[model samples]
Target: MENTLQLDLNRSSHSCREDFSEYVAHLQLHMALQARNLVPNLTQAADSREQLLQETQAEFEKLVSRQMR
Candidate 1:
């Protein structure tokens, strides 16, 4: 009985370790996927902001030239 109990405990411990490791790996993969998704959105936002800035600058230059004339 004692030997059986010891074996059961060892199996439970090993199973718990495997479960924890799997959970950690799943979280890492989820975070990586989230980051992968976010990178393109962030990059697009940056590009849009840059484009807006350039358009605004061009409009401002045109206005300044019109005012000078």
Candidate 2:
């Protein structure tokens, strides 16, 4: 009876390990997709923000072009 109980415990542990591995693989896949989706938008947002800053700077600097009497 003790041997049977030990065998059952071993089987349960093996199954749990397999399930954990599968869950990890799924999580990795989800994270990869999330990263892929974010990269392009993040890059584009940074570029757009830079362009806006440059345009605003040019406009503001133009105000300084006039001399104060």
Name the candidate that leads on lDDT. 1
Best by TM-score: 2
Clashes of 2: 0
* TM value for model 1: 0.55
**Model 2 Cα lDDT, one tens digit per residue, 1-69:** 999999999999999998997777666656555644543322233577766755554454354332111
Q: After superposition, how far is residue 11 of candidate 1 from its true place, in Å?
A: 0.2
lDDT of each: 0.63, 0.60
For each candidate, give its TM-score against the true structure: 0.55, 0.56
lDDT of 1: 0.63
- The Cα error of candidate 2 at residue 65, in Å, is 58
| lDDT string, candidate 1, 1-69, tens digits | 999999999999999998997777666656555644543332233577766755665565465445433
Q: In model 1, where is the ten-residue run with the lowest total lDDT?
A: 36-45
Task: Please identify model 1 stretches exceeding 4 Å from their true place.
Answer: 41-69
